[model samples]
Every structure is written in structure tokens, then in C-alpha cells.
Target: MTGGPATDEATEPYRRRIAEIWSAALGTPVTDAGHHFFAGGGDSFQAALATATVRREWGLEITVQLLIDHPVLGDFSERVARCVDER
Candidate 1:
């Protein structure tokens, strides 16, 4: 957390993967796993796309609200990982 780039560098692979999906779905550049989805000008439609992306990527059927609750890529990845673990 010292250097800004270092923080992003420390992002988990899953978070990085999800961040890529989010950027593609939202048509914006999202390089940080700690980014807030809605604050980045994302809407419900984009959230849906992101949710579907996650499903395709991890085979996890999660709601858009899950993304809403999780917002950041790292937290979202954690939530999805927990859901997968629960099953």
C-alpha cells in the first residue's frame, strides 16, 4: 500500500481478472482492484454485464446486487470466491 503501483501490483489474480472484465464491460479503463464500480460511472446495465462476465469466468451465478455490495474488484472476487466455496 506504499506505492500506488505497488498496491495494484499486489492485487490477486482473480481480482485482476475481474478488473479486466469490468473495464471491458464498462468501456472504461480500470487498472486498480480497489476501484469503486458505481463511482467509475457504471450503471445497472454495466453491472449486469459484469455479473454475467463473472459467471462466464468462474461459473458463479451471482446477482448484480452482489457486485453492488462488493463494488471493488478485490471485494467482489472475495464475495464470489466465498459463494463458490459455500456450494
Candidate 2:
């Protein structure tokens, strides 16, 4: 808890949102951080679509390669948060 509860709490919504996006893209309920999008029957095309959706939904600029590089929702969210913070 060194990061503080407030910081942790702030990340929760982002995590949940990313999870929802992942679930929607995969067309299944996914609640685990270990879930791999591509391994779970998602293709590059799907990843591209998902990236576009995330960009539009989150208002963050992201590329399909970024989604492919970070397939897990948690990782993607962390990356996106970093990108947002940098901007």
C-alpha cells in the first residue's frame, strides 16, 4: 500500500474499464490479468479493431502494435495510463 490507497483506488476504475473493453472485444467475460487476447482466439485484425475502440473510448492515441504487444487488459491499461500521464 506504499503507493497509497487513493492511487490504488484511482487505478481500479481504469482496470475495470480495460477489463470491460477486453471482455467486449473477446466476446466473453474475462476477469483475469493472465488472459491473452490473441491466444484466446483474437487475431491481429481484432486487435486493430480493439485498439481503435480503445483510442476512441479512452481518448488516448494508441497503435494496433501497442495492443498486440500488450494483450492483457491490465498491461494495456497500465501502458495507456502512462501514455495519458505523459501527455
Candidate 3:
């Protein structure tokens, strides 16, 4: 939430992958990491689906509350990358 979006070379992969998952879950093409998931027609169910997909694909546990906290794709992806790195 501070500085610019939490995106960089390190978090790019997570941004892209999470975007793909979000696109599938929301049934919309998500091209910008700046796009907010909820603003882009996402709901609780879609968030759950995306979260599950992320967990299955990356073996990382991301909660819906986390998603809600970081609704922006870039921010969420950065958090995901951090979680992966921490593991």
C-alpha cells in the first residue's frame, strides 16, 4: 500500500500467473496488474476459485481475506511472491 505497486522483475511471474487465474475466475481478460479484482466483476465465489487455483498451482496458501486486503493484482501478486519466498 506504500510506494508504487508491488511489482518488479521478481514479482512479474506472480503477477502474470495470478492475472491468468483471475481472468479465468472472473470470466474477463485481465491485462493490467493495476486492475482491481472486485472492480472487475469479481465476487466472493470468484475470489475463492482464484485462491484455490493459486494454491494448487503454486502450493501457496492465500486466503480470501488477503485477496480482499490487496484487491489490486500487482499488490496481491507481490504478496503471493513474498509468501512463496518465505516458504
Which 10-residue window of candidate 1 scores lowest in summed lDDT? 1-10
Please write out the lDDT profile of model 2 over residues 1-87, one tens digit for every residue.
244666556566777877777778778887876678888878877787778877897788789989788887667767776777777
* Model 3 vs. true fold: TM: 0.90
**Tens digit of per-residue lDDT, candidate 1, span 4-84:** 554444446677788888899889988875789999989999999989988887788678989888897777866776677
Question: Once superposed on the true structure, which residue ranges of model 1 sit more than 4 Å away at CA?
Answer: 1-11
Compared with the true structure, all predictions reach lDDT values of 0.79, 0.76, 0.88
- Greater TM-score among 1 and 3 belongs to 3
Order the candidates by lDDT, highest first. Answer: 3, 1, 2
Q: TM-score for every candidate vs. truth? A: 0.79, 0.80, 0.90
Q: Is candidate 2 or candidate 3 better by TM-score?
A: 3
Global lDDT of model 1: 0.79
- Give the Cα error of residue 29 in candidate 1, in Å: 1.5
TM-score of 2: 0.80
Give each model's clash number: 0, 0, 0
Question: Where is model 3 more than 4 Å wrong at Cα?
Answer: 1-7
Model 3, span 1-87: residue lDDT tens: 344434487889888889989999999899897999999999999999998998888888678888999999988988888899999
lDDT of 2: 0.76
